[model samples]
Target: MSRPPLPPFTRDTAIQKVRMAEDAWNSRDPARVALAYTEDSRWRNRSEFVVGRAAIVAFLTRKWEKEHDYRLIKDLWAFDGNRIAVRFQYEWHDAAGQWHRSYGNEQWEFDDAGLMRRREASINDVAIRESERRFHWAAPGPRPADVAGLGDTPE
Candidate 1:
């Protein structure tokens, strides 16, 4: 199955791919998110390594469970051929109600069908007060158009 805006990416198509990924992740639906990857997708998220869609689904399920009120933004860093790199930030509170913002960079490699086959991410989190949160859209929703992206302001 083809996922289109299929590789050999132009600048515009790459940006569209980034936005589509951002929107899918914002939905916080593990199944929906996993669908963007190849059936045998491999990922390194922080120190954990996960392989295949089933593993991806399990990992995301655990993540969203611990991270309450999650919101994320992803900006295109670069792209070529079937690879795209992204810089991202996300905010969420834990079960104890401690708020944190995570900053990360991800490198993605996609199959010819435009499904990501490998993803590597490095992320760090900083504790913040709830009042300092910048991503205040409704839970499990996309960032609205009026909200500025990471490109607009230095963090």
Candidate 2:
């Protein structure tokens, strides 16, 4: 199955792709999110190396289990040919109720079919108090239209 906004992306399409990904991740459904990648997709998320959709699903399952009430935002950083780059932030609390915000940059390479074949991400986390949270939208949902993006502030 081919995903839309296929490669050789324009500015608008790249932005659309980024938002689509952000929305899918916000859903926190591992199986649903795995469909966006190729069957043999490869990923480097932080220090972990994962390959294939099944592995992706397993990885996400473990992740969401530990990251309670996760919310995410992704901004398109650049795109060319079949590749796109993104900068993202996400907030989640551990089982112990300590909140942490993660900042990351991802490089994605998609096949002609628009399924991501390779992904590389580098991320860092900073602990924050509950009151310091910037993303206040409901969990497992898209950011509201009224909510500002990373570009809106110097944070």
Candidate 3:
């Protein structure tokens, strides 16, 4: 099955793809999110290496379990041919109620079918008080239309 907005992305399509990914991730459903990748997809998220859709599911499962009340935003940085770059930030609290915001950049390479075949992400985490959180929308849902993207402010 081919995902829409297939390769050789233009500005609009790239932004759509980014928002689609952001929405899926905000759902916090590992199985649901894994469908965006190829069966043999490979990923390097932070320091961990994961391969295949199953591994992607497992990795995300472990991640969401630890990252309580997760909320995320992704902005399209660039795109050309079958590759896209994204910059993102997410906020979540640990089991101990310590809130943290993560900043990252991801480079994605998609197959002709539009499924991501390879992904590389580099991320850093900064601890913050709950009151400092910028993402105030409900959890496991898309950011509201009224909410601004990272481009709106320096944060």
lDDT of each: 0.94, 0.95, 0.95
Off by over 4 Å in 2: none
lDDT value, candidate 2, whole model: 0.95
lDDT of 1 at 29: 99
Considering only N, C-alpha and C atoms within 3 Å, which residue pairs clash in candidate 1? none
> Which stretches in model 3 have alpha-carbon errors above 4 Å?
none
Record all residue pairs in model 2 with backbone atoms less than 3 Å apart, i.e. clashing. Answer: none
Q: lDDT at 4 for candidate 3?
A: 80
lDDT of 2 by residue, 25-131 (tens): 99999999999999999999999999999999999999999999999989999999999999999999999999999999999999999999999999999999999
All candidates: CA RMSD (Å): 0.7, 0.6, 0.6
lDDT of 1 at 85: 96
The 10-residue segment of model 3 with minimum total lDDT is 146-155
